[model samples]
Target: MPISYTDQQIREKAASLGLIQEGADLPRQLRGKVVAAMAYGDAAERHQAPEPQLAGEIVIHGSSILIDGEHFPWLVAAQPMDIGLNPDGVSTVRLTLMAASVQVIRPEPRPESEH
Candidate 1:
């Protein structure tokens, strides 16, 4: 099975592929706003090889987006999910970016009995 890549690895690969340039961050137009991108594949393709779910939250500021949820302020953020490789070997994903600050807050703990 192909190994999954770390956030850093993915970032580097993206840069190498020219999807992103060195030291370039998410577009400023996407800052503080949420946008979504989606891709679709045929059912037969899924039967041949299943894909893993890729979803996460991120923060974006200026020209940078944090990979994982970290304490890095002033960085732009974009979350890409439902990643898949097309027949042409082109990887696709549904990406969303926040136009402004995006806060990912943990759900509040409820009473044990509530579970």
Candidate 2:
């Protein structure tokens, strides 16, 4: 059986994975940043607890995403689609987005003698 997830649950998972921002239009954002799309599945149990693992190469360019899979015709139909991970080991989807604005503060440089 497929695992059921609410919209909030899905959004929370995406946020934790760094796939989407808190209030951003996830689907629209993903579409804007897609270079390619593909269907994915797991080698392990199909109905496992966690989502399926994606075993492939996915390159994330500036607001562009690329996915490569053997059976991914749905991707072609979707053109620009939002990507998310399933916690049932059913399939895998990759995503790419614009260079986000997450700043990292660095300490100011000090003179060698100050050490």
Candidate 1 lDDT tens digits, 1-115: 4334444544554466566677666454532221211111233455674566443544444445453566544422444455575566545544554456558889899999999
lDDT of each: 0.48, 0.49
In model 2, what is the error at residue 40, expressed in angstroms? Answer: 12
lDDT of 1: 0.48
Worst 10 residues of 1 by lDDT: 32-41
State the lDDT of candidate 2 residue by residue for 74-103, as single tens digits. Answer: 323323546565566544454333333647
In candidate 2, which residue ranges exceed 4 Å CA deviation? Answer: 28-115
Tell me each candidate's TM-score: 0.20, 0.24
Residue 111 of model 2 has an lDDT of 97
TM-score of 1: 0.20
Error of 2 at 48 (Å): 10
